[model samples]
Target: MHSKIFRGIQQEDVQVAADALIAEGLRPTIERVRQKIGRGSPNTVSPMLDNWFAGLSKRLGVANASDEQRLQPPEPVQAAAAMLWQAAMQLAKHAAQEEFLQENQKLDMRRAELQNHEAELISRQEAFNARQIALDETLQLARDQLTAMTSRLEEAGILQARRDREIEELRQQLKSREDERDAELQRRNDDATRHADERLRLEARATANEHRWLTELDRERLEVKRVVSAHIELESRAQATQTQLKTAQAALLDRLNQAERSLKDEHHAHELAKMHILELQSSLDVCRLAYAEIIKSQASQEPKNSRRKPLKQLMRGVTVRRKL
Candidate 1:
């Protein structure tokens, strides 16, 4: 980015050119300065022109210039030039102070904007954190509910097992009762056979003792009635046991149905919780994407904004430099 340079333009060259322009009764504008010096940026030459004009005005006994000079003061003009230089320095300092203040004001505005952006970002982050925590709590609650449902299912399984064992025990007791009834029936049959044989023997042997035979027959009849009564009682007990078994089976079936219903309900609740979680996750994703886009956009714009025009001019040497 180097530009063509003008050779041989020294410190005295600017003053000599300005004096010649003044002799021609023309204002020593930068255009006049560059036309005489033949090379320099507007930034380099303009301040030199301001100094030349300000010095000329001071030689005529005026004061103040907002610029510096390359022209050396002659011995005759030294005291007046020094006063003029001081006034010019003061004017330049005031102008620089004004520019600095203005720049600071701009910087303050930019900082305030950045601060506002930061506050907004913090608010959004806090909202995100709160929402995430809420989701976590909800998920935890769902997990707890699922755990409870599983525990209940285990309890139901144990209850079903207990019912099966109870039913098995009742069946064993009913079988034992039936076996006892069968044994009693066999005993009654044998007693009937013995009584029949005794009556027949008595009939065959005793034509004398009719009163004793009649008494033995009446005793056999009473014995038969007692066996029948015991059979009836056993049958009643078996019927009662069957009723209890049926009731227990029905109750067990009801319990199974109730457990099934509860499991279904729990499953439905679990499904709803999952759906809610999914919805929250979707919302969170959307929010994250939006925030990411905002940050990306902000990042993209910042560098463009940071590349200031004054800085660019300085880099390109469009402006002059202080010698120090």
Candidate 2:
């Protein structure tokens, strides 16, 4: 294949250039020839120029090398050489013209292929741009959704915090109530113990009184025959003492029953309070579990920073929306 760059140059163009250079006292060297022709290959131009020079040398008695001996040709050979030179010039020009046309055809085909490639690239770029825009829209929508979910999570957290605070207060109250109940139970026990001691003291006093009455009765029996009036008075005093002992026993029994009932009621109250406290603790545990699940769900939905809307921002949003 010919050089794509220098294919447009013709043989006649090279000859004309060589002749002009010769007139200017410059030898048609390869570099000069290429400069004169504007553009041509050494391979294509060198052979054509060599043939033209050989034909000329055949026409004249001249040596191509400055040191070489010259030889003369016959007039018939000279005339034939001149004719051959003309024919060779015509053939060289024709070949160059055909090659130039072929090169141009190839160039046109290359340009068309490049244009088709450019069009395909442009379509692909447009499709990529559309896809990028779609991706951007989807990303923005996801961000908005994340923000909304974050706000909801924050609100849930706030409610949970309030609930926790309330539960803590209730726990404190329950603790205080338990302390009071324990103190009251201690006081009731002290009272029951005090009453038991008092009952024992009363029983001891009644027994002593019975022993004294028995001793006095034995003495009165011994004196009954000697003093009836004195014996009757002593007997009446013994009956009054017996009645007081029965009254004291009845009062002691009533006090014991009342204390036992009070103890039962207090125990029942303590058991009910314990049940309520246990229920509160159970509900608190459930609330904690539910809150943990919500947090886990939010974390799974998005990245930490992506889903987290700050509390201040959330509050601001709520205020703004309310104002609007």
Candidate 3:
């Protein structure tokens, strides 16, 4: 029922307000129509007022006919009525002109607001395009760096694999050398043992031969004393006894020379045995030095824990050689 309760004034409401103003004997200008309706803008009221004015002549003709049949008006009253009608028409025209100017000003303001909004949208679109280009370039750089890193990682892997293979080959070679050294050490130890036993046997043999030569020399000295006593008692046959003593003395001297030669030969044989023992000892020492060198090389190449067994074996071999 109230115009204020609605979002905007309707055409029917405007018409009603204009008709009411006419009834009150007032010109239906935009402001007068709004004042009657209680709410409406000039832009909305102007068109409605024009429609009402267009039909006003027909309504006036019908009213005038009815009034003539009822009673004729006096002449002065008719003239005043005609003059009021002309004044109302002129006021309506002026109101319409003012409303048209106000509408034109509002239209110009709306067009400017729309143009500003369009410019803001275009600026935002350009900024978005620039940001997208930067993002794409950054992504490409990251991909290139990733590819280079992957290539380096692959190369490092290949180099590591090659080093591992070479280390394995070195280990195999060291193992073979150790085996050969162990066998040679065993052979040398056996030779040393044999030589030691032979030396002991030769020493025992030399001692027995020396004892036998001393006993033979003592018997020859006793025989020479007995022969001298017999020669002194038998002087009546001095010539034959003297001849026999000379022959016995010559045989004793020959036996002494033979025993001396035998002793010298035994001493020479004992010296040869000692020289052999010395040679065997020297050989064992060489073997020990070579084994130590092998151990040193292995220790440097291998882990400490892995070297323990080989070191123990070398120690055992040295102990055996010492005993020999």
* Candidate that scores best on lDDT: 2
The TM-score measured for candidate 2 stands at 0.33
Candidate 3 minimal-lDDT segment of 10 residues: 298-307
lDDT over C-alpha atoms for residue 5 of model 2: 44
Q: Report, for every candidate in turn, its global Cα lDDT versus the true structure.
A: 0.55, 0.57, 0.56
Question: Which stretches of candidate 1 lie above 4 Å from their native place?
Answer: 1-102, 189-318, 321-324
What TM-score, over all chains together, does every model reach? 0.34, 0.33, 0.32
lDDT string, candidate 3, 89-151, tens digits: 344334434544554465445445445544654564565456545544654555555455456
Q: How many backbone clashes does candidate 2 have?
A: 0
Comparing 1 with 2 on lDDT, the higher-scoring candidate is 2
User: Order of candidates by TM-score, top first?
Assistant: 1, 2, 3
Model 3 misplaced stretches (Cα beyond 4 Å): 1-94, 190-324
lDDT of 1 by residue, 28-146 (tens): 65556667777775445544555665466678755445323445456667666445544444443445445445555755665575566556656655665565565556556555665
Q: Against the true structure, candidate 1 has what lDDT?
A: 0.55
For TM-score, the strongest prediction is: 1
User: Which 10 consecutive residues of model 2 have the lowest summed lDDT?
Assistant: 298-307
